[model samples]
Target: MSNTQGPVLVIGATGRQGFATATSLLEKGWPVRAFVRDPAAPKARELRSAGAELAVGDLDDEDSLRPAMEGVHGIFLMLTMMEGVHITAKGIADEERRGKTVAELAAKAGVAHLVYTSLQGVHQDSGVEYYDAKEHIEDHIRALGLPATILRPVLFMDNFATYNRPTRDGDNLVLALAVLPHLPMPLIAIQDIGRFAALAFERPAEFLGRDLVIAGDLLTPPQIAEILARTAGLTPRSVQVPVEQISAFDEQVGKMFAFFNSRPTPPIDITALRTTLPDLMTLEDWLRATDWQA
Candidate 1:
């Protein structure tokens, strides 16, 4: 369809990134079609109420995707690995299989621009399953010759709000992942990620064939701990937990930590992205507007 106003199909529209992206597109007056597994889900109902056309589809079923793609101009594709699957079977292999299938199907459907959400540090030879899976998807997207933009987002700022802080109970406390004190990490807000993806679709020609690293701010674990302390009104302490002990924390959490430790370098060009989208939000702005305490 040559009409620029055609709907954009968004997979995973009930989740964080998809919800944000769909909302942004609606606010910008773009017709949005959200692929959801269940039309009865609260999130799906909310999307419909917000003016998004709902399409029932599952990532595990390739045939269900086409109905959403019919006459669509662009798509935002994202897939989450099944929880508690074996590291080999559930983690990397599963992600690769699903991502590849989705990309191939999108290309076959004649999608004009495809925006694939990937992880930061995916291209580096990190030997991590999740990161490797992302790399595999990137490779497949390139091989398909689709007009695509790959967004490698930094660590989620919301992740720290959920997992890093100690429980409200006074007896338990948690610390940072890395053993090295003052080790810096790149982070970005999920809302900003949606904004970035919407802009990529708006200017597909500028973003096509480009791998954009999208990071909001850089901070050490200690700095993050301080932010938590200030935001939560607790005496949060920053301790350097040994990387090997990550598994004891949580299997998937540990694997993620190992991946982070393997490559402690930042990948995105934040300055260049700022040049492209000048109003990008910063961490301070996000925190101020966030309901962390609530």
Candidate 2:
């Protein structure tokens, strides 16, 4: 376990953040053991092709995770709440259970370090069910006295390409969200989360027991729209849709936005984070790197 060359197990290795982390670890020449439910799945196969050893298992089942933890030095744990994307009570409970089970199993295996990806403001009692669920797992990790690092990432920049993508409105591409036009929202590229996780594993002494809240940039909705328009060659405008409207459409997301509006801004020290990961991508940088054409 003390051996740095030993594999670092990546839970949920097929998902966005997990895939990024597993690839980062492999690129850094660290042996990676990807914990996947289906080793033959596309992303899992992709990891294997890139030199990762697959450990097939489900997070809900503790016995299934044991073999993955065996002989591993560290674990990059991220239980994405895709199951509860709509935010149901059962989804929240299932996520919390999955996360805690991983922490408990990691501790029992005597892994050297555990890096958990959580959301920002989970400690502020935001009453956001998903964030609260993550906080519960964080508490469990601490209570177990596991040597761990917690990375609290802010909003994902990738949201723009999916659910938050701009909609065409006559001559303009309209971007709408529950946040005010002037509120500075912290944003991060998912790849940077992977880079930061790799950094933590590489420098265990500096990161162990630390709770790092990370973001690449902070911009208002209007500012974000301007960047998108300028980079993607589209006429973009941002409108502040009422939180109530958002809640009417998606109750869970509405609660998150309501919490976002309640706070002046999220807690993320980009300046300090830069000292650690100087190559963190800004919105413009991210836009340039991807195929974000309208």
Candidate 3:
């Protein structure tokens, strides 16, 4: 592999963000070694078909990861809390352990660069358990003296297509979220996150030791609803769900929303980000590109 296009081992390669990163790297002519728990999985097979070499392994098993890290130019670290969305105290602990393990292994393997995808505002004490765990992992990476680029991405725009999708209410779609109507929420496409990761791996001098907060656009729920109506051809109504109601269902998600409401607005400069990543997508751009439907 060429120095600029060295092989990259992408953790969580079958997942949304990891798949994007791996695909972007391959598009840039960089070799990709996708670390996956199951090589037979559809996404993993897709990655292999798209020119990524599959490295079957689980993050929990250090031995499984060591072989994948061998001779890799860089590592893209993406860890899930509790293996999915539901975050418990034990889940938080497991997340930290997994993160620290990856960092430690990367350092041991003498990897050239490590790119970690952390949550936006995780540097601050959000009082959210999972956020705190991510911060701790960041600290561990720094403490290990790893040559790493930390990308703190805002909420994924893809969430609107799945997790926070609008439900049909007669002829109109009801977009109900715990966020306040007027509060501007920063969002980035999962694909954009991958694009940035590839850029970092290609140009380590500009990205190493840097912690970037990335966002494609900042829009309120109502504005997002409007975008959905205009871009996706849907009659959408924005409903601000009570935080308490969400808390009653999912305490972790409720705490996350409460923290979002606590902040007046997320701190992200899209214009500046555009200078770095010219193709950084806006809500409309994402909607049009994905052909998102309610």
Give the candidates in order of lDDT, highest first. 3, 2, 1
Q: Which one is best on lDDT? A: 3
Model 2 agreement with the true structure over 228-266: per-residue lDDT tens digits? 877766787999999989888677788999998887665
Once fitted onto the true fold, the runs of candidate 3 whose alpha carbons sit more than 4 angstroms away are: 1-5, 83-85
Model 2: ten consecutive residues of lowest lDDT: 80-89
For model 3, residues 97-176, the per-residue Cα lDDT tens digits are 99999999999999999999998878666778889999999999999999999999998899989989888777677788
- Model 3 lDDT vs. the true structure? 0.89
Clashing residue pairs for model 1: none
Q: Candidate 3, clashing residue pairs?
A: none
Please provide the root mean square deviation of candidate 2 (C-alpha atoms, Å).
Answer: 1.8
Against the reference, the lDDT scores of all candidates come to 0.78, 0.88, 0.89
